[model samples]
Every structure is written in C-alpha cells, then in structure tokens.
Target chain A: MLAALAFVAGWPLARTIWFGFTDASLGSLADAEWVGFANYLEWFDYGDGEGEWFGLLADAAWWEAVRNTLFFALVTVSIETALGMVVALVLNARFPLRGLVRAGVLVPWAIPTIVSAKMWAWMLNDQFGIINDLGVRLGLLAAPVAWVASADTALIAVMIVDIWKTTPFMALLILAGLQMIPEDIYEAARIDGVNPLLVFWKVTLPLVAPAILVAIVFRALDALRVFDIVYVLTPNNASTTTMSVFAQQNLFQFDQFAYGSAASTALFLVIGLVTLGYLRLARLDLGN
Target chain B: MRRAVGLAKRIGFWALVALILFVSLFPFYYAILTSLETGTAIFEPNYFPEVFDLRNYAQVLGQGSFPRNVLNSILVATATVAISLFLGVTAAFALARIPFRGRKLLLLTVLSVSMFPQIAVLAGLFEMMRFLGLYNTLGSLILSYLIFTLPFTVWVLTTFMRDLPIEIEEAAIVDGAGPWDIVRRVFLPLMGPALAATGLLAFIQAWNEFLFALTFVASNETRTVPVAIALISGASSQETPWGPIMAASVIVTAPLIVLVMIFQRRIAAGLTTGGVKG
Candidate 1:
C-alpha cells in the first residue's frame, strides 16, 4: 500500500515537475529535449544588446489565471467561513427539526460538482432561468442577467456555487469544534446572565478558532485548484478561468504539454506552501 | 416589548431554517420541474411543473451512449471500490495492529497522500496511461482514480481498525492462525460496517471524478456520464439541450443523494471524507 501510494502520488508529481523543464509536446513526448526552465522562461536575444524574457511566467494569461485563482481562494474562503459559522451556530442550538435542516444543508455538498454546474447553468439561464424569473418578480433586477455566460458575473457565479456547496462542510467542521468545548463553559456563562451574543464572541469563537482556521486552509487549497465547476459552468469564459482550468486547457485543448506542465508545477508549488502550513498546524495540534 | 422581541427572534430563526432548506434544495427541485416539461414549455420560465412529461427522460435514456456511459461509470466505480477495499483492509491491518519500525512515518505519509490535487500529476499520469495503452479506456480512469480513493480508504479503515479491541486478534493468534488467516477469518468479519462505509465513499469519489475521466478518454463509448453531459451541452445556448441535460443530471445525482442520506453518519466519521465531488 505504501509503495502504491509512492507510485501514485510521489512518482507522478516528480515526473510532472521534470516534464515542466522539457520541451515536450503531446504529439512526440518521448524524444523531447530538456529545455532547462525554458518552458517557464526563456531569454530571447534580438541582437544589439536587446533581449526579452519569454515563457509561462511572462505570459499575461498565466498571470491572469494566477490572480483569478488567488482571488477565488481568498474571497470564497472568507465568505464561506462567515456563513459557515452562522450555520454551525444555528445547528448547535436545539431546535425542532434541526436534524432535517442539517441534512438539507448537506444537499448542496452532496451533489456532484458537474451536476451542480449543470443544475446552476440551467437555473442561471438568462432567458428561462428561475433565478431570473424570481429576480424580476422580486424587482431585484430590471432585466434577466446572464450569470455564467456573462464575463462580469462568471467568477462570482462560480464562487456562489462553491460557497453553496462547501459552506455546509465548513459548518460541520466548525460544529465538531463547537461540540468539543465542554458544556460547563456555556452553562457558567448562562448562570452569570451574560448576553448570549457576548458568550459567543468571547467564548465560542476563540475556542473554535483553530478548527475554523484548519477548515479555511483546507477549503482555500481546494478553491485554488478550482476546475470542474469553472470548466463546466462557463466553458470558455476567460475572466473566470482559474489555474487548474488554464492548465487543463493548455494540456489537452491547446496541446502545449510542456507549458501546461510548467503551469501545473507552479500551481503545485503554491498549493505546496499551504499543505506545508497545514502539516505544521496538524503537527502542533497533535503535539498538544 | 420583551415579548415582541422574543416573537421577532422566533420568526427570524424559522426564517433562517426555511432559507437553509431552500438554498440547499431548490436547484434540484427546479431541475425536476424542468425535466418534466416538454416541447416549447420546456424553455418557458415556470417555477412549478406545468406539464408532466417523460419525453426528456426517454430521450436521455435513448441517447444511445448515455446508458453506455452510465454502465462505464458503474463498472469503473465498482472495480475501484472493490480493489481499494481489498488493499485497504490489509493495509489497515498492518498499520493498526502490527508493530514495526517507521510505522508512524508511514502512517503520516499515507494520510498526506489523500490531499494531493489531481492536476499536480495530470501530465505524468496522461503519459503513463498512454504508454500502457490504457488511454481512452476505462482502465485509465480506474488507474488514476486510485490516486484519490486508495489513500482515503486505507486511512478511514485504518482509523476504524485501531478502535477495534485488540483481544480479538490475540485470541485469533492463540488459535494458531497466521497473520493472513487471522485477517481473513477474524478481522474481516468484524470489518463489515467499516468496509461498507469506506467502499461507498470510494465508490462515490470514483463516480463523481471528472478531470481524469475527461483527460484520459475521448470516445463517447468510453466517456463517463459527467463528461457526456458536458459535451452535449457544451455547444451554444440555443442548441444546448437543457431538458435532456437536466434529466441526465437528475439520473446521475439521485443515487448519490440516496447513498448520502443512508451513510450520512459514516461520511462524517472523518475530515472531508464525504467529499464525493470536487
């Protein structure tokens, strides 16, 4: 099993990084020459002491993908964290049919990303979408807005779906943290006649902060590599294109294997930083 | 004034509950409504089902390759789950019960393997699959999907194995059973619930994966349901068959919803174990 994991996880990642340094194309992968970071950046000399740097790092679209991915990760993680706290707090309370609501929250989480993409694509349809219908009826919009198709709202649309899908998961993780705090803490606060809101701000938030941090980091790592939803939600919308989507399009659609490999390697490094942080956090928690 | 504030709070709480339920489920409900509409009515904006029509379902089923894709998904998911469970059980056994050097490091390594993003190894896996002549075949999918499922299964089952009382294994050993025999005879019997939960989770992961299925395979016959629906609706909006697409989406999601409901607790057993979708 260990060996299988090494082969599955370690070997491929190593080779992918190695391939990023080569001039390999999908057509003739075997005989490709080592380009030594040429795929990432190449110095092109036009003589007369003039030279230009070229490669993935120099590409505007690649930078856009990076910015978009970072933006998505930052914004979605923030919104999802706040909303997830609310959901967790609500579920923590003893209410009638709380279990039902909890289960319902998982509904979005349960649906497959591609299926949700399609479902949302239909719902966000400008002409006949129920969202447009409701929006117009509620006077929220003067006209039907193309949610996924329009460049202005495409990434927002993707972020909205992601939050809808992942907030429940975040809530559950936070709830676990909330459950870990001994009941006596809250009981003592109640006995003191402290405001419920103050109790939450002073006690609950501090206690659950670690778990919420872990959840945010995990969800951020996921959002950074956002692909299927973006790919399926708005196929060719460049404004909403993320790092994973850009890498995939280059790898398969555009057939720039080496360039795509470079993009993948860069993304791996970015995510690797977060994974290391997570590992450190996990270690600290375990040490306790 | 105090009573009024209390009443307002009550109303606010119920309203929040209603909002949660609506946000959670309205898309799927609207999908069902849309799938049941036929002809011109299918394109018309309506919150409720205006017509009860089975034509979309029939069309999706009759799309020739849709059923084949579904079968492909089933076969791939089943094969992946079966193999993952088989390997996971033995791995969990060793990791849980066996005393060995570097065990702790190995266990941590196993746990971290589950966190690998699919894109990190896409290019290399594509090359390997093509070299093995498994590209565009279901074999490619099963092979790549193990990168996700195997780690998860092994980790989940291993956690479960550690919590089981050690006396059972000791008794098996006293009965003169070998390690493999004890595993098969003693541990396997007790692993029913853990095996099922891990198997179901692995199955869902394999079923919902898209990047590998999309990148590795090209033919309609070999494409999974997700990619098939994606290709069908990938065309421009006017020609995008929303009704058939909705029907297909519902078909793929129904089984998952049912499984999730049944195994909800099993899913929450670990961190992000219920991540059947990405």
Candidate 2:
C-alpha cells in the first residue's frame, strides 16, 4: 500500500521526465517522436540557415530570461529574508494582539498569488492607479508612470508584488525557528553583559541558521519557477519574462509542448541542485 | 541604568519590528482601498476616496463569473484536501510504525519528489491529463495538485506520527485490533491538529494554484478563483475596470484570510515541522 501510494505521488513526475526528451504533442500518444536532446539544443538558437556555435551564443532572448529569473530570485529573496527575520524577531517578542498581528501578516500569503498580482496590477495602473496618484501627491514622481506597461518598471513592479505576497511566509517560518531557541540561553547571555548585537550574532544567528537556510531554499525554488504573477501582471511584454514565463509562453500560448517540456526540465535541475545543497548544508535528517 | 537601557532597547526593537509588519501589509490595505472605490473616483488622480461604494462588489459578484469561480475553487480545493489527507495519513502510519524495508530510501525519494518543481512535470502531466480524457476537468487539476501535496503530507505526518507514543498503538495491536482499527481508534483523535494543519496547507495550495489551472482549464466555468481574478483585469486591452477587478480579488481572498486567522498557530507549527522533515 505504501509503495502504491509513493508510486501515485511519483509516477506523474517520472512520466514528466520521460516526456521531456520526446516530441510528444498533447493531442496524441502514438505521434510521439523520439528526439534526443533536440529540444534541449533548441534552447539555443535553431533558426533556419543559422550557423552552429555562433548562433547558439547569440541567443540573447534565452539569456535575458535567465538573467531576469536570477535577478528576481536574488533581489526578492534577499530583501524578504532581511525583512522577514526582523518581523520574526519582533513577533517573537511579547506583545498584546501578537496573534492578530501574526495572522494579519499571513493574509497576503493566503491570498491567491493570481489575485494579489491582479490587485497590484490594478494599484499600479498609470491612469487611475492609487499608487500613481499617491506618488504624484507625495512628490515621489511628477507624472503617472506605466509601471507594468513598460519593460523598465515591469520587472521591478513584479518583484515588489512577489515580495509583498511572500514575505509573511518567510517571517512565519523564521519566527518558529526563533521560538525554538531556549529563553534561558538569551538570559544567560544577558547575565554575561553581552551587547544586543553580539547576542543576536553569536547566539541567535548560528542557532537559527538552519531554519534560515531552509526558508531561503524553499523561497528560491518557488521564485525560480515563478509564472502566475508575471503572466498575469505583464502579459504580451518581453521585458518581464522569466524562464518559467518563457517556457509557459511556449507551452500554452505557442503550443511548443516539446520545447516547453525541455525548458521545464532544465528548471527542475536548477532547483534540484539548490534543494540538494540545502539538504547537505542543513544536515537534514529524514526518516524514522 | 542597565535596566533602563534594556527597556529602551526592547521598545526600539519592537517599534522596528512593527514597521516591517506595516510595510508587509501595506499592499493588502491598498487593495482593500481600491476595491471599495468607484471607478470614476479612482481615476480622478486622488489617493484617498471622497466617498466609498460597495457597488464594485455588487457589479462583480452579480455579473463577472465570480460566484461560479468561487464554487469551482471550493469544490476543487476541498476535494484535494480530503484526498491528500486520507492518503497521506495512512501512508504516514505505515512508514512510521510498520518497520518495513526500503523505508529510509522511500522517505528520501518522497522528499526529493516533493522538492522537484511542478513545471518540470507540466508537459508530461498535461499529456497524461489529455490521454486520460481528464483535461480541463477539476478532477485533472485535483490529481495534478496531489503530486505536490501528498508527498509533503506523508512526510510531515510521518514526523508527527513518529512523535506519538508507541505503546498505545502496540497495546491496540496486541488486543487483536487490525491496522484499520488501530488507526481509527488509537491515532485518529490524536491526529486532529496534524490533520487540520496538513488539510489547511493542502487547501490553500490548491486554492492559490494558478499555473496548472491556467494551462489546463481554458473555460470560465472550470476556472478557479486565482484564474478568475487574473483574467478579470483584461476587460479589454486598453481598458481594465480596476474597481471590479480589485473587488473580485478581495472577495476571492477573504476566505483564505479567514482560514489563516483561525489556524495561525497550527499552520506555523505544521510549516516548521514540514521544513524539519525536508
């Protein structure tokens, strides 16, 4: 029964891997052409009459998508981690309405990603957006800016929405880690006349390092494979496209199923490496 | 003097923390603000509304496919939660107590599978869904969602099951209770918190899922809340009715917020435990 259950959990994923290397259309199973590495190679330019090595190197679109993905992951995850730890540490401290505050923080997280993206998109509209209105009124800008319409602001706009939607999740996880540290340990440090900064660095940081790593790993993996926010926020725009968006465009919008599968397979490996890195770093011991 | 200094530092730390929380929640506040405003008022280059109207909700709820989407979302999410928990709890018991061979390898493989990005399997799953004639059905969406939810559920529940006392289960077994009986009478009551937490996690994940739902379900009748709200912004290419879209976003998100509020502590505990298991 356990084996059967595990099989159910894993069979679809294994099938996914198999489909990546084949030119399988969604329309039929009998038409799958076994094209080994053709899809992967096609990640580089495979245009008609193209030279081999130079053409591959000149695939700027794929590189731009890669760059945008990495930039999104790096910026959003770093900001979220710093801000989340602070929120976690604060929630760890005693206060009235602590439960309410904690719950309030999770509201964005619980809100569907697509919903929040739409909400942010509406708020950032150039003509009637509250953000633009506030920006002009507060002297932040001279005129309404098309935050999601243009390439320059589209990526940043998407990042802000992503960070707003996910920081609560990071904070909650880190807060759990913060609570796991014994109060007596901190009290002991205080008795030794340790400064606040030293106590946090020497005592809290090292002890909570595992949780922080876990949080980053999970967030990074999700961010690397992000799709819905960018898709909903900036459709029909090239500037804000991440790898997932690019792959999705091929899969759904363009019906390039084989190529999209290959792209998704590449993403799987990137995230798999990160997960393995975290498992080693955290010395994560699973099993009875 | 030292006590005074300590008190001041604590106050400052809390204030800083409160500031972060405020920033984190500011967009949601803005969402509610925009949702409550009239389109004419919102387009007037005004940051604050002079008058509030619930007309956006009335308009969106009455016409814009919100109600049908909500019903579809609830049905899909509830079914996903139920199926994931049922399978996960049973499998977790077998792993935690059965002393079976390959248990360790199986656990590791399940964890790794849980970590694998869903997109990697998108094309394959899509093909399979099409093959099985389940494409664009809520059933297909639920099954695809199980790929992520089940493994994590089993893993997390295994951790929780391990923490339960062994003697209680052993005694039940000695009394000639079968596996089903032992699970029902001995463990089910004890698993309320774990079940609730895991079920809630699975529900929220299914509720918030977008990519698969977007790719698979093309019609408005089968579309979930996330997809509904997402497509709402495109009343036209040149004109998006912000008031109705924001209103729909809020209405769709309200239930999720309630779920989080009621189960905040359990959700936090479950998340930490799942992380540890991973």
Candidate 3:
C-alpha cells in the first residue's frame, strides 16, 4: 500500500522537484540537461527594470493570478466560515424537517464543481440570465451586468459560486463539533441566566474553535489551489486566473515544462509550509 | 410582551430556515425547470416549470458521446472505489491494530499525501502516463485518482477500526485467527458502514475530479462526466447550449443527490470523524 502511494504520489512529487531544477520540456524529458537554479533565477529575475518584465515573480500576469487566488481564498473562507457557523447553529437546534434541510444543504456540495460552475455561468449570463432579471426587478441594478465576463465582477462571481458550493462542507464540519459539546454545559448556562449571545461567545465558540480552525485550514488550502471553477467559469481570463490555472496553462498550453514545474514547485512549497505551520499550531495528531 | 417576543423569534427562525432551503436547492430546481423547457422557453427568465419538454434530456443522452462519457465516469469511479477500499482495509488493519514503531509517521505520511496540490504532480504524472502508454486512456485516470482517494480511505478506515471493541479481536486471536484472517473474516463484516461511507466518498471524489481527467484524457470517448460537461459547447462558438448543459448537469448530479439523502448520517459521521479526530 505504501509502495502504491509512493509510486503514484511520492515519485511524481520527487520528479516534479527534480524537473524544477533542470530545463526539462515536454519534448525532452529524459534528455533534459542540468540547469541548476536557472529556472528559479529566471522566475525571480527583476529584469533590471527595463522593458517588459520576465519570470513569474516579475510578471504582471503571474502576480495578478497570485493576488486573485489569495483574495478569493481570504474572502471565500471568511464568508463561508461565518455563514457555516450560522447554518450549523440553526441546524443544531431541534426543528421539524431538519433531516430534509440537512440533505438539501449537501446537494450543492455533492454536485461536481465543474457542473456548478457551468450552472452559475449560465445563470450569470448578462442577456437572459435570471439573476440579472431578478436584480433589475429588485432595483439592484439598472441593467444586466456581465457577472463572469467583466474583470471587475469576475472574481466576485467565482467567490459567490465557491461559497455556495462549499459552505455546506464547512457547516457540516462545525455541526459535528457542535454536536460534541456536552448538553450540560448549555444547561448550566441557561440556569445561570447568561445572555444567549454571551453563552455562544464564551462557551460555544471556544469549544468549537478547534473544529472551526481545521475546517478553515482545509478550505483555505483548497481555495489556494482553486482551478476548475475559475477555469470553467472564466477560461483564460487573467482577472480570475488562480495559481493552479496559471501553472496548468503554462505547463500544458505553452509547453514551458521547466518554467511551469518551477511555478508548481513554488506552489507545492507554499502549501507544504502552510500546512506544516497549521499542523504545528493546531497540534493535531493523526495517529490518535 | 414576552409571548410576543417569542412569537417574533419563532417567525424569524422559520423564515431563515426557508431562506436557507431556497438558497441550497433553488439552483438545482431551476436547472431541472430549465431542462424541461424547449427552444425559446429557456431564453425567457421563467422561475417555474412552464413547459414539460423532455427533448433536452433526450438530446443530451441521444447525441454525441455523452452516454459514453457517462459510462467512463461510472467505470472509473467504481474501479477507484473498489481499489481504494481494498488497499485501505488492509492498510488500516496494520496501522490500527498492529503495535509497531513509526506507525504514527506512516499514518501522517498518508494524510499529507492527500494534501499535495494536483498541479504539483501534473507534469510528472503526465510524463509518466506517456511513458507507460496510458495517456488518453481510462487507466491513467483511475491510477492518478488514487493519489487523492487512498489517503482518506486509509485514514478513515483506520479510525473506524480503532473504535471497534478490542475484546472481539482478542477473542478471535485466541482462536488462532491470524491478522489476515482477522481482518477478512472478522473485522470486514463489522465494517460495512465504514466501507460504504468511505467507498461512496471516494466514488464522489473520482467522479467530480476534473484536472486529471482534463489533462490525462484527450479522446472524446474517454472523457468523464465533468470534462465532457465542461467541454460541452453549442453548434457554433457564438452561443452556449444552456438547455442541454443543464440537462446533463441534472443527470450527473441526480445519483449523487440520491446517495447523499440515503446515507446522510453515515456520510456526516465519516466526514466529522475524519476531519475533527484526525
């Protein structure tokens, strides 16, 4: 089993790391010569402030993708975490038809990201989209807005779709954490006549913080690597291109295999460091 | 006065519940409604199902390589689930029941493997597929999907195996049941729920995976549901075939929705345990 995982995952990871150092291309993977630090240098080169910056670090397009990815991750994670907490709190309450609602919430999450992106892309169509019609009807917009087409609103459009599809996952995780809190703690708070809001702030939030943090880290990592939604919703649009999208475009479309590998290697390092930092901070033990 | 305040709260809460339900389900409901509308009906912004046209569904299923893509999705997802479960069960037994050094490290390694960005491995994996002559084939997808699916299966199954009462295992052991015998004859029977939950989750992951399917498979017939739906275009590049797209989306999502509804409890348990406990 370990060998299978190593071959499928580990070996490829090692190959990518190795390729990041060499001038490997799609045409010549085996015959690629050693070019230690050249790919990295080219990626980080400042270009002496001349005309037309080169390398990923100096490239405006790469920076745009990085900014879009981080902004998307930050906004979506915040909104989803807040909304997920609310939904989990609501669902945690005893209510009629709760199971049905729970099942309903999972529908969006269960749907494929590509499918959801397509559905939203159609719904956000400027001309005959229901969203525009409703926005007009509600006096939200004077006319139809091209939600995914225009650069101004494309990131927001992607974020909305992401929040819709993934908030359920966050809610489900927090709901599990909520269910774990002992009933007596709430009962005690009620007997003490504490403010309901205060009770939630003091008792519930602290107890569920671990689970919420875990969910946030997971979602953040996922959003950092956002690809399918951006790719399908706004293909080749620099305004919404994420790190993964940029890497994929370069790797496959441009066939700059070594340069793309460098980008991907950098991404892998960032994700790896962040994950390690989070694990260290959270002190989560998988063996337990 | 108190009664009035309580009444207002109840009304507000129910309203919120209604809003949540609408937000959660309205898109799919609209997709279904749109799928049932023909030619010009879809152009108009109609909320409810005005027309009962089955042509869109017929069109998506009847034309092109959609049915073939759906078959490919099913085959790949089922194969992934079966293989992941088989590997996960045996690995979980070793990691869960066996007392050995470096077990923790091994388990952590499995956990971290799932978290690697797919892009990080794409170039290498693509090269690998070509080298093995598996590019554009279903074999590439099924194999690449293991990078994501196996870790979760192993971790979740290991957690489930740990929670089982140790007394039964000891009893079986006293009767001379070896590790393989114990895992197969004894524990596997009791692990039906865990197996089902993990298998379903793995199936969903494989079905929804896009990057690998998009990159690895080039032929139209080998495309999975996600790639096929994504690449679905109209007769001309000017316009998108929304009606057929919605129809196909509905078809692909229906099975998942049904499965989720049926196994909500188990799925929730699996996710929470995997997330929180891990």
Q: What DockQ, between 0 and 1, does each candidate earn? A: 0.64, 0.58, 0.66
By lDDT, the better pick of 1 and 2 is 1
Error in Å for residue A75 of model 1: 0.9
lDDT of 1 at A13: 89
Clashing pairs in 3: none
Task: Give lDDT tens digits, candidate 3, residues A202-269.
Answer: 99999998889989988888888889999999998889999899899988899888888888898898
True contacts kept of 3: 0.76
| lDDT for each residue of candidate 2 in A108-224, tens digit (9 for 90 to 100) | 788788877887887788877778978888899999899998889999999999988888888888998898999999899889999989999999998987788889988888889
Indicate the worst ten consecutive residues by lDDT in candidate 2 chain B. Answer: B42-51
Worst ten-residue run, lDDT, model 3 chain A? Answer: A44-53
Cα distance off (Å), candidate 2, residue A132? 3.0
Q: By DockQ, who's the top model here?
A: 3
- Candidate 1: C-alpha RMSD to true structure equals 2.2
Which candidate leads the pack in lDDT? 3
List where candidate 1 sits over 4 angstroms from the true fold.
Answer: A277-288, B1-7, B234-237, B271-278
Q: In model 3, what is the error at residue B207, expressed in angstroms?
A: 0.6
lDDT of 3 at A91: 93
Candidate 3 CAPRI grade: medium
